[model samples]
Target: MSSESSKKRKPKVIRSDGAPAEGKRNRSDTEQEGKYYSEEAEVDLRDPGRDYELYKYTCQELQRLMAEIQDLKSRGGKDMAIEIEERRIQSCVHFMTLKKLNRLAHIRLKKGRDQTHEAKQKVDAYHLQLQNLLYEEGKYYSEEAEVDLRDPGRDYELYKYTCQELQRLMAEIQDLKSRGGKDMAIEIEERRIQSCVHFMTLKKLNRLAHIRLKKGRDQTHEAKQKVDAYHLQLQNLLYEVMHLQKEITKCLEFK
Candidate 1:
């Protein structure tokens, strides 16, 4: 019993010593893991002078990148505005050109209408002139026919008076020849001769009347010629007026 107790006690003492060594090994391993973790997670300690220099460099780089982005955005907005303005200007120019063309076409149409109206008025005026001329010509021809109708009756009366005067003259010449044969009847014959001389004077008066009748007939013929010439002149004037009216009518129709 004593020897068995000694063996058990000896194993216990050795186990106790091993326990101390194991505790020491575990403590060293824990320390090494803590050291490694601390080194891996450690924050850099700043040097005051170097810290300020690095901060300034980082701020400059950030400002440069921000300024470049802002410049690109500004340039893009300006380009877009310029393109929009150019399109607007082009549209306005095209609209103005179309408006001017429309105005010109309207003016041309108005001018054509005005010319047509003027031509119509001219034709109307010429037609009125032609009608007036024709009326005047008709009145002149009617007056000339009335004068010609009156002339024949006047010529017959003058011819009958000339024949009566010739018969009286022949009777006077026979009485004078009978008076010359009787000498003793001188006084009676002388009275008969005086009667005969009076008769001859009557015959000479009749001849003078016949000459006046011939002069009147010649004057009437000359008057008729003058009237004919006036009628021809009026007819020519009427022709000219009619021709002008025709030309004006044609122009109006064409318009």
Candidate 2:
């Protein structure tokens, strides 16, 4: 009956990978130790996926001191070093944030360069196709001319019509060449404008990232000052406790 009740009362357990498992109702001493180790593993912090998540995590670390501070106060204990260490961690958080921003900037810059290269490649491909088309057209004309030279008795009217068609094609080829040059120049200008815009946007992001970093540092500094004040207050309180104990001892002796 006791074993059944214990099993019913056991809560479900979750692993670090977030999988749920059945909790054991009873365990031997070794199994209990293994369970404690598993719990420790499950409690390990996971990697933060985003900058905001990392920032939130750091903020949580700072806020977590409230519980610790309360427990210390209840115990009449002073541990100011934890607050100081937290301040150092906050400073490192800002540095990591800056690195994240720099990494984003590098990624964006690389993307822009890749896009520009792809555009250039596409233009080159189009130019190559145009050149191939012009070559094929010229080959057709040369073949027609060779046929005409080999047979002078062929219809003069047909030969004249072919010449006219050849001239029209040549004019069209010249027009295409001019248009292609203009189109390529426009594409180049557009790419340059895009590059400039990306650069300006990256600069703006960097400025904003730094501004946030400064704000976080200022807040951390303020928190550090507050922590220092609290530490001093705790020290004063401890001194008072010591004085009161000394006075109590003297009174007991006098009695």
Candidate 3:
């Protein structure tokens, strides 16, 4: 009794490939044509054949239930049988809803995998760039600190695009590290470290140069003031000597 009840209660499971079974007594359809059209709707069903598969399914199940109502005719009145058919149709609708939910879940998973793969590709390309930089002379040291100057208000769009979960980025880096990329990874990291130090040194040197230039200007001004004072004193002494010589000449003439 228990086994029979279980079998009766079991759902008519839709196969993984989207095809229903051959008949009420069987499992899934073997032929490919009976299978669901595709993962994506070609033109959202009405535009083309995209909706054809789902609706075709509904019509098929409706016909099947109507046949079953005919079988139930002698046992129940026409009205009651028709009502039961209506209920069966509702069940088919529920089944299709389940299928849709499954498909939606699959699409989400696929999308996530694709995004992670692309993110990994982006990181790999960046690592390759770092490796290439190893052959060239230091450049970012001379290049302006564009990253440091990033103003959040001025670059709101950029910040929005870049600001994802820090944990996700860390996980990706850790994943890369664990993949036995030790040598290349270390090299790229060392280069980044060097780049940072280089930029800091350049900034410091620029600041020191400005200070030295300002001090040189101040010293030059002070030297100019001293020279002007000396020149004024020399002129005053020459004038006094000339005045004395004139006075002595006058005295001699009087004697």
Candidate order by decreasing lDDT: 2, 3, 1
**Per TM-score, what order, best first?**
2, 1, 3
Per-residue alpha-carbon lDDT of candidate 2 for residues 28-79, written as tens digits (9 for 90 to 100): 7557667643322321222213434666665676566556655555666346
Position 156, candidate 1: lDDT? 52
Which lDDT tens digits does candidate 1 get at residues 75-112? Answer: 78766665555545655554554454445445534643
Best-fitting candidate, scored by TM-score: 2
The residue pairs in collision within model 2 are none
- TM, every model: 0.29, 0.30, 0.28
- Give stretches of model 1 more than 4 Å off: 1-184
TM-score of model number 2: 0.30
The numbered model that scores best in lDDT is: 2
Per-residue alpha-carbon lDDT of model 3 for 94-191, expressed as tens digits? Answer: 57755764575466346445545554566567655875795475554321244345343544443343333333444554454334333444543443
Candidate 1, residue 70: the lDDT equals 55
What is candidate 3's TM-score against the reference?
Answer: 0.28
Cα displacement (Å) at residue 227, model 1: 0.8
